[model samples]
Target: MIDFLPMTREDMVERGWDQLDFLFISGDAYVDHPSFGPAIICRLLEKYGHKVGIIAQPDWRSTSDFKQLGKPRLGVLVSAGNLDSMLNKYTAAKKYRSTDNYSPGGQAGLRPERATLVYCNRIREVWKDVPLIIGGIEASLRRFAHYDYWSDSVRRSILIDSRADLLIYGMGEKQIKDLSTQLSTGMCIRNIRDIPGTCYRTESLEHLWDYIEIPSYQNVAKNKQEFANAFKIQYLEQDPIRGKTIVQNHGEQYVVQNPPAMPLTTGEMDEIYDLPYQRTYHPVYEAAGGVPAIQEVKFSIVSHRGCYGSCSFCALYAHQGRIIQSRSKESILREAGQLVKLPDFKGYIHDVGGPTANFRQPACEQQANRGTCRGKQCLFPSACKNLNTNHSEYLELLRAVRQIPGIKKVFVRSGLRYDYLLAAGDREFLRELCEHHVSGQLKVAPEHVSQKVTQLMGKAGKETYLKFKKAYEQTNRDLGKEQYLVPYFMSSHPGAGLKEAVELAEFLRDTGYHPEQVQDFIPTPGSLSTCMYYTGINPLTNEKVYVAKTPHDKQLQRALLQYRNPKNYDLVYEALIKTGRRDLIGYEQHCLIRPPQTKQLSSRQPRPEKTDKPGKQRRLTPTRNKTAKKQAR
Candidate 1:
């Protein structure tokens, strides 16, 4: 009864169940860890007294593997693993990736491309009529019509294409419990369409009330302007309290997305994380090199959920929402105590943070009751007047965890919003962070230095990051700690042209920090930045913005970030010339590059008068010549 949920028919029979209530199909191998969505959901369902089975990474070429676990009594739950299948199989450049960390042995090509659609289709072929519910990152992000980066075209909701009966978006613990509870009572999936945090297709809108209708999918698909217009409406309605249900016409039927579910209270979050997860991949995978994804998160603890950072390119706001929900300090400490008891527990606790590490409370007290303001962010344009900027609770939580015996250090590896930290006005937190949490280096995301580009990215001004940097350095100096700050940067973001790219390079040079890892803006589905990338206009304002789409241009922008690398010299030189910044290519100390050495110039005599002029040479004579020769030698 304590083992992993039935993966084989024999295991199901051993559990004395003739049929399961839900059969969970996932693109990832079975890892009964809380970090994996499928595991958390399945464990929660089992905790609620429903029987469940898992069919992980089933063969998609045929239905034979899909039918191995037999049909569920109520429904079939489908997911494309923990990550979007498209992102898992392809890089940002749209090239096929060779390995999948979610699979055993870190194998490649275990699941087909677009795993959610393929898995749902396979389930349909097997059952012919079972309720197919798709939930996961892939289904969550694509629950509405959005641009598909791989195909460079607009795609309709995954609910429409996959033919699934229901799509649960966001962190679907609450929604899934409601779904399973209703299914247990014999209510059909179609009739359970009123659940918040869920989406379904309907032919009639008679029962739906208080819903706003977005532009039809056909219209958005045809008109870029209409797509941007529709997206703005969707973005505004993500709040749980004030958000209205959204309906979009797709031909004869409609895709109806209910309002977001309320975030879990502290007690509810504690219960979910405190579940009896095995905390590792299934033992069956030990011979296959175990799950590689768990290695990073196995020792870490997720103390909070959701983020208020609201970076335009990030899908967290759209997927996890802007609400900040956290686990109780007791719950977090209890988990830490358990972590220290594990055989693999090192003195170091790898990380202790969530989407944005320092955000331990709601953006404002009213957010939990009134919901986040539509079309306005808590920390964008400028920090909202109502924003709550404090890190006292978070700082105390970190201190409490580290005080537990057997734990040496706890780092905050997840993103630390520098702007928010600056807004908090707590020098104590900065001092503690530099003194303890930093492991020789701390990573902060400034994204870019240009104001125009940062605005488009939904980040604060460069001055905020600069302020944090000064404070952090001062804290380290006060403590006599020899730690450094590693800032993360991006390239090829919307509204970032050659000019902005060069500006970022100059900023990096001034800071004397060259980032080893750089991210080219990937226009993933279900993000405001993706809307801008596809439409070439700011979706929120309809203002035209520059975008770097071509591979050459994107590479040049990326190269500019690491212009010191010899391998990037060609791309950096090309970017400088193209941006009319040829002055940055000289031998000056501030230059991004030294002028390229030419075959004709490498062997030329050292005469002061010889310039690029084709056939002219002037020489100095007498005492001037002797001084010149001595200088040259």
Candidate 2:
């Protein structure tokens, strides 16, 4: 019988345990699903014969909650849930988000801002000297001194601020297991610093060998150039196979980061995902309507991990790495079988992919031994000659899952790399995807259509997206399905000024696309785009880039994307005027918006006489009575 990991002391007592080997502190509600990182790590630790318990979204206001589980015999693991705490609590506009999906009842403010630091500080007040470790997205990306958008200043590495003994960076299955083994052997947490995929602070450099030292914290904090240079080195050396040890000085102490943990093999990936995950939030959250985040992944399956898409704004390159690690077909099928047996299976498999769904294998054969090619992207600018754009294995897995009994439809809701799909020259996958997987609409992230913007975003050119769009529409038509393509667009990304935003608006106008939601680029820590947003220079190329920094500037760019929305008329009008593109504000068919004077004039026009006969109604001219035309429709 599979059950959630012990959350309260009574849970441990029920299992005939008086103490825990490790107590995990999370910034999210207890959801023991594979999609949640804390659950995976806790379950893996349990499998290793070490007693583990979790305290999810503990009250950081006092040490009483931190003391509920008492101190673990080994250490305490801290994570800011699946997402960065700040990102989860705030939107791009730095406004407080109304709800947190990871929290029970979809309520917000359960977790404090800078949650890892806050939780760790509370733990210190309670236990004083308990082994403290921090990981997950928050600590992983902030393993070095970098910019913090919220504070609008450079903050030190999370290790230094949180005062953690060790910081585990990537997908931490290997690092956590290794750290557990060493600790089980009675090694002190401070001495267990040689593990890969982990970071530690040290005052002495004598013990460290074969490492590249980037700019110091003081240097990066004050100098934008040094900041970009440091990020450049970190970005290039993120691979597991060929990456070297990276060290950065923070005043008197130094933070050293080991090469990332190797990508999981097929069997290893299987074992991790196959672990006894209850596949939902704990029963304690039942009263609060359960953790809202579980709805998306409850009936879904993760077929792979990691991505090589290398979108500048994406943090997958820094966290999951560029190498792709996919589970075997049998493993995915087994999970799908479990989903079928679920009490609320609903006969639909929501998703069967990860980070970038279509990426099942590495970009090239050389990645097996050499790691991802440094300073080069597989799908940016254009598909590399060495790229492996195969979809046979993934297509086969999808087909197999669909064959499972009790399954009605298996959809690929995760992101699809259309460029890779088109490059493969395989129409069969597209046809099958259109005929079966699409659930009325398929979402793709084109981000932007302007050549300058797309180039800066490290996405494929506009031509590629146009080709894919054409192919997708045609495939759906041939399948006799009316499925639509929902393309996601971003605004105010670095290099996107009024000129570029207008270009994107024109593209949307031309394509007859009115996106309901527009993503305004947020400069989160550790992504290449964040570096660009901060330094006004592309870290990779050291070229100056335009950044829409002011709140008004960002609003204008965002409004331009949704120009058709009546709520955005003022911003759109101002943007068009500012860009000297007032030509776009006229009543032309290609215009993004109608001029204010024209709208006023049309509103002032008299209403036409009511017609009793359907075909005998007077037709309104194109120029006059625009309001009457709207009312007639």
Candidate 3:
């Protein structure tokens, strides 16, 4: 019978286990789904015949909660859930988010900031000598001494702060398996530091070879140029095949990172997804309305992992790597069959995609043998001549999934790399996507339209997006469908200024597309864009970049995206004037917003005469009342 791993002392008793081999502490609620990273790791460990138990969202205030699972026989694993704790708890504005979907009932404040550090410290207090290991998105991205957006400073590697015995980075199935074997064989954690995809602290680097050392923490923290230089080295050497060990010094101790683990083979990927997963949050959370985060992935299938689309603002390069690892169609179909048997089956399979939905194989044949090219991207600026842009395999997989029994419709909700899709020149896939898959609307990310901004973001420019838009519209017309394209746009990236913001607003105006939501770039750890944000220079190209650092400056850039919204009128108007583009504020058909003079005149003439009847006053229209409310504010 498939059941959740032991979560409490009672659960341990029920399993007839006196001790767990590893105790997994997570900041997220106990979710047994494969989509959750903690679940995957824990379930994989259990599959290896090691007993594992979880302590999810433990009270970090004291050692009381940390001691609930007693102490593990071998080690304790810690993770800050699926997301970095700081990013999950706070918004780009550095304010507390009202809700955390990973928590029960969507409550906030269940986990502390820098949750990995806090949880590790608590574990130390409870079991001073227990081996401690940290992994997950929070630990993986912040493994090196890098910039922290929340603190607005360069902080030391999480290994140093959390005092973790070891740090595992990336999708760490391989690393965990190797580490567990060594530990089970009676090897000390400190001496077993040569495993790939793991980072460890050392007093000296005497034993390490074929490694390159970047600038020390002291130098990078004080000098921006040194910081950029260090990041450039780290970014280039992230591949598994060609990458070398990277070491950085922090005072007397040094942090050494082993080369990344090889990407999972198709058979390995199938084994991982085929693990017996309960596929939902633990029953303990049912009373609290369960975890809100699971709803998005409960029915959706993850067909693959990794992406070749190296967008600068994304950290996938560091975490998932550039190599594309996919599951076999047979594996995916089996998962779909399981979903169809669920009691909540609604006939609709929410999604059947991954990081970039249509990417089902490596970018090119050589990537499998030689890894990705360093300091180069497969899809950016332009698709490389060697890039394989075929969609036949992915198209066939989607077709096979749709033919699954009891499956009515399978939507592709994940963002598709439109540039890659177009490069494939597969009109059949496009036609089939429009004819069968899309759920009335398909969302794509063209991040920005300005040529300079798009280049900085490592995304396609306006011309490419426009071409795709035309093709999509024509395809829909051919299918006699009224499908729409919802394009996602970002604001206030490292190189974007008021000028680029206004250019984007103009594009939106011309297309008659008013986006309901605008994404403001957040410079999270481990991304090249974050390096640019902290140091006013692109690490890869040492060129000076414009950064909108102040709150008001960022506000103006975001406002320009939704210029039609009356609430953003003031900031949009200010941005237009600041950029010397006041011409866009007129009453012309091409104008984005009306002149302040016109707006003022209209608001002032909105009051009507009082009614003669007692207690009867004329009600104002929503537009007039909204204007009045803005004026009062």
TM-score of 1: 0.94
**Range of the 10 consecutive residues with the lowest summed lDDT in candidate 1:** 606-615
Q: What are the models' TM-scores? A: 0.94, 0.95, 0.95
lDDT of model 2 at position 8: 87
Query: After superposition, which runs of candidate 2 have C-alpha atoms over 4 Å from their true positions?
Result: 600-633
In terms of lDDT, which candidate is stronger, 1 or 3? 3
lDDT of 2 at 250: 96
User: Over the stretch 1-633, how does candidate 2's per-residue lDDT look in tens digits?
Assistant: 127788888888889889999999999998989999998999999999999999989888888888888789999999999999999999998999999999999999999999999999999988878899999999999999989999999999999999999999988999999999999999999999889899998998898788899999999999999999999999999999999999999998999999999998989999999999888889998999998999999998998889999999999998999999989999999999998988988999999999999999989999999999989999987899999988998899999999999999999999999999999999999999998899988889999988888898999877888999899888977878877787899999999999999998888767767666789999999999999999999999999999999999999999998776677778989999999997887656677777685554333322222321111224457765665456434
Model 3 lDDT per residue over 1-633, tens place: 128888788888888899999999999998888899998999899989999999999999878888888889889999999999999988998999999999999999999999999999999888888889999999999999999999999999999999999999999999999999999999988888888999999999889898999999999999999999999999999999999999999999999999999999999999999999988888888898999999999999999999889899999989999999999999999999999999998988989899999988899999878889988888887999999988999889989999998999999999798899999988999999999889988889999998988888899989999999999999999999888888888999999999999989898777767765788899999999999999999999999999999999999999888776677889988998888997887756677766786665333322222221111224568887677557645
TM-score of 3: 0.95
Q: Higher TM-score: candidate 1 or 2?
A: 2
| Tens digit per residue, CA lDDT, model 1, 1-633 | 348888988888898889888999999999888889999999999999999999889989999888888888989999998888888999878888988999999998999888999998888878888999999999999988889998898999999999999999999999998998898898988899878999999999999788999988899999999999999889988888999999999998899999998898999999999998888898888999998999988989998989988899989887788898899999999999988998988888888989999888999998877999878888888888888898999999999999999999988888988888887888889888887898887888889999999999998878888888888888888999877777788999999998999999999777766666688888989999999999988877889988999999999999999776677778888999888998887645587876675212212222212121211234445776466445444
* Number of colliding residue pairs in model 2: 0
- Positional deviation of residue 160's Cα in model 2 after best superposition, in angstroms: 0.2
| Rank by lDDT (best first) | 3, 2, 1
